[model samples]
Target: MRISPSDEFLADLERLLLDQGVAPDQARAAAVAVGVEWGGQSVYIRLRGPYLARAVAAAYDGANVGELATRFRISRAQVYKLLNKANEADRPQLEQARLPGT
Candidate 1:
């Protein structure tokens, strides 16, 4: 199947894949190959999958991936995966906690 992408989409994918050590040409190729187009022809394609968790863990003051991974007692890969899931599940709780009456 073919896919349609926004200009920003391709750029973002290219950047993320390359940052993950995917070779330039290979990153472009892989990002191109891994994509799905929706009814409106918008595509959501990613090479590194969910990275927000890794980013969040790293964002806490003075905390890096190694530190967060150590705290979690898991390989860096599992930390990324679990953090991704945790961010999603925590959103509702986060919103509730943020409410004025909370």
Candidate 2:
């Protein structure tokens, strides 16, 4: 399956580190190590929140909300909130796509 860009980057970094003489396990660990915590949330979330929200919303439409909440370790309410935010964010783009006279 196609992986996310972050995952791909980590893999590449690990390989590069190994080539540079880092031990195998250490290279892998270093590749996955990211110091992203900020203000009670991860920098990953801060940067990718909207994208994640939209992905969550799409999954909510096709999958079990409870399972999604459990997997994300977030409350059901938060799941809904993300979905709503995603929908709101999508509205303007959707509106702009409509025929001008229609």
Candidate 3:
């Protein structure tokens, strides 16, 4: 299956919000809200998925790992694993977030 442009746009908006210094949870929630409004739950879930949750956690400024594990319904080990992968997957975003003005 292929991603539609709207799906891509929503994902981009999430990243943009994060890059612009919006809280990770807020950015993700905004994207999910827009996705649901424009498409539906299935579309939003399909596009965002567990990986996006992991990414949001990674970008999150001070998230507690245990709490994140509980919230995302994953084991702490899995959360650490996914966070590592997410950091690698979106290294540029991490870098951008670290920039002085961001």
Candidate 4:
């Protein structure tokens, strides 16, 4: 599936990359590359780590699926898929966290 990232989202991503120490020019270039691929059609950009965590947290906080899809520029199905994957990955840590203090 493809995501048509919003201009705001792309700008945020560029800023994030910059914050992570990516060169300003490189960060902008990367954002632009992701934003415009396949002759100006939508492209796929995998959301991982903190991005996935935030999305899942929003869902758990009762954000509407359609709204999340629009905000994240992904389809509703992709949001569900990401949530499932995040839940699965977090299960072990969550269970461990519930254990007695270290």
What's the lDDT for all of these models? Answer: 0.64, 0.74, 0.76, 0.75
Q: State every prediction's TM-score relative to the real structure.
A: 0.35, 0.51, 0.37, 0.43
* Residue lDDT tens for model 4, 25-61: 9999998887676445655656655576565555565
**lDDT for each residue of candidate 3 in 16-63, tens digit (9 for 90 to 100):** 999889999999999999977877545435533666556656555665
Better of 3 and 4 by TM-score: 4
Query: Number of the top candidate by TM-score?
Result: 2
Worst 10 residues of 3 by lDDT: 40-49
Q: Compare candidates 1 and 4 on TM-score and give the better one.
A: 4
The clash count for each model shown is 0, 0, 0, 0
Identify the superior model by TM-score, candidate 2 or candidate 3. Answer: 2
Q: Write the per-residue lDDT of candidate 2 for residues 6-96, one digit (tens) a residue.
A: 6666788788889879999999778766412222233333633676687688778555789878867778888888888988988999999
Candidate 4 RMSD computed on C-alpha atoms after optimal superposition onto the true structure: 8.4
- Model 4 weakest 10-residue run by lDDT: 37-46
**What is the lDDT, from 0 to 100, of the residue 66 in candidate 3?**
82
lDDT of 3 at 8: 91
Candidate 1 runs further than 4 Å off: 1-5, 35-40, 43-51, 54-102
